[model samples]
Target: MTQPVTLSVPCPDRDCALSLARAAVAGRLAACANIYGPVTSVFTWNDAVEEEDEHVLTLKTVAARVDELATLLQTRHPYDVPAITWETCSADDDTLTWLADETR
Candidate 1:
C-alpha cells in the first residue's frame, strides 16, 4: 500500500517555487504541487536575524518517491540550505489511488 506524503519547501520567490513545482510534476515525481505565499518569514542565518517574503511550495507524492523529490529540490533549489521537509498524510482511497496513478 502506498502512503501519501506532503513535502513542504520554502522558496525565495514565486518563480523559483513555480519552477520546482513544474519540474516535479512534469517528471511524475509528484502528483501535485501547490504554491502558496508571498508570506513573511523571519529566521536567523549566519549569526544574523533576517526577515523576508517567500513562497511555500507544497508537493503531494507517495512514500516511495519522497527521497527522489527531496534530492531534486536539493539540487535545484536556490537556497543554500533549503528547508525541505515532508509529513505523511491521510487521504481518501480514491484520492490516494489517483495520486499513485498520476505519479507513476
Candidate 2:
C-alpha cells in the first residue's frame, strides 16, 4: 500500500486559498485541504524581516501525488514563490488511514 503525506501551504488571500484548495481536492492532488483563518506571519523576504497576515491550509494525500500536487500548486498560486511545503506524517495509524481514504 502506498504511504500518505500531509502538506501545509500558506496563501496570502482568501480567493487564492479557496482556489488552490478546490483544485487540489478536485484533481486528487490532495485528498483533503483544511483552510484556516488569517494568521500573522513573520519571515524574511528580500533580506529583510517582513510581517504579513495570511491564510493557511493543511492538505493530506499520498506520497505518489506530491510531485503532481506541487506542480498544480505552483501553476495556479498567486505568489511568485508561494510556500508549497509538505511533510511525511508518522503521527498514528488512524490519521494515516484517514488521509488515504480522503479522496474517496
Candidate 3:
C-alpha cells in the first residue's frame, strides 16, 4: 500500500518557511504543512559540526509528488544550501487516505 511521505525543510526565518509552506499546499504538491520557528539545530557542515537557530517545516504529501515538492522547496529556500529532506512514512491507512484526498 502506498503511504504519505514526510518532507522536512529548515528555514532561516518565518517568512521563508510560510511562503514555501503556502506554495506547496496551494500547488497541491503537499497535502499539509506544519511550520514551527525558533528551533535549535546542531549539525555538520563544511567538514565540521555547528549549531544554529532556524525555523523548521514538515510537509506531508503523497510519494508521487515528492519531486514537485523538492523543486518548490529548492526554488523558494533562502539558504544557499537548503536542508530539505524527505522520508516515506508508515502511517495509518485512514490518515494516508485523507492526505491523498486533500492534496487533490
lDDT of each: 0.96, 0.83, 0.87
For candidate 1, the 10 contiguous residues with the lowest summed lDDT are: 95-104
lDDT leader = 1
Question: Using Cα atoms with residue i matched to residue i, what is each candidate's TM-score against the true structure?
Answer: 0.98, 0.85, 0.87
- lDDT tens per residue, model 3, 4-66: 899998998888888999999999888889988789999888899999888999999988899
The top-ranked prediction according to TM-score is 1
lDDT tens per residue, model 1, 1-104: 98999999999999999999999999999999999999999999999999999999999999999999999999999899999999998999999999999889
lDDT per residue (tens digit) for residues 67-89 in model 2: 98889888988888887788886
- Deviation in Å, model 2, residue 91 alpha carbon: 6.6
What TM value does model 2 have? 0.85
lDDT of 3 at 30: 89
Model 3: how far is 63 from its true place, Å? 0.6
For residue 97, what is the lDDT in candidate 1? 97
| Range of the 10 consecutive residues with the lowest summed lDDT in candidate 3 | 75-84
lDDT score, candidate 2, position 52: 91
lDDT over C-alpha atoms for residue 53 of model 3? 84
- Using TM-score, rank the candidates from best to worst: 1, 3, 2
- Give candidate 1's error at residue 3 in angstroms: 0.3
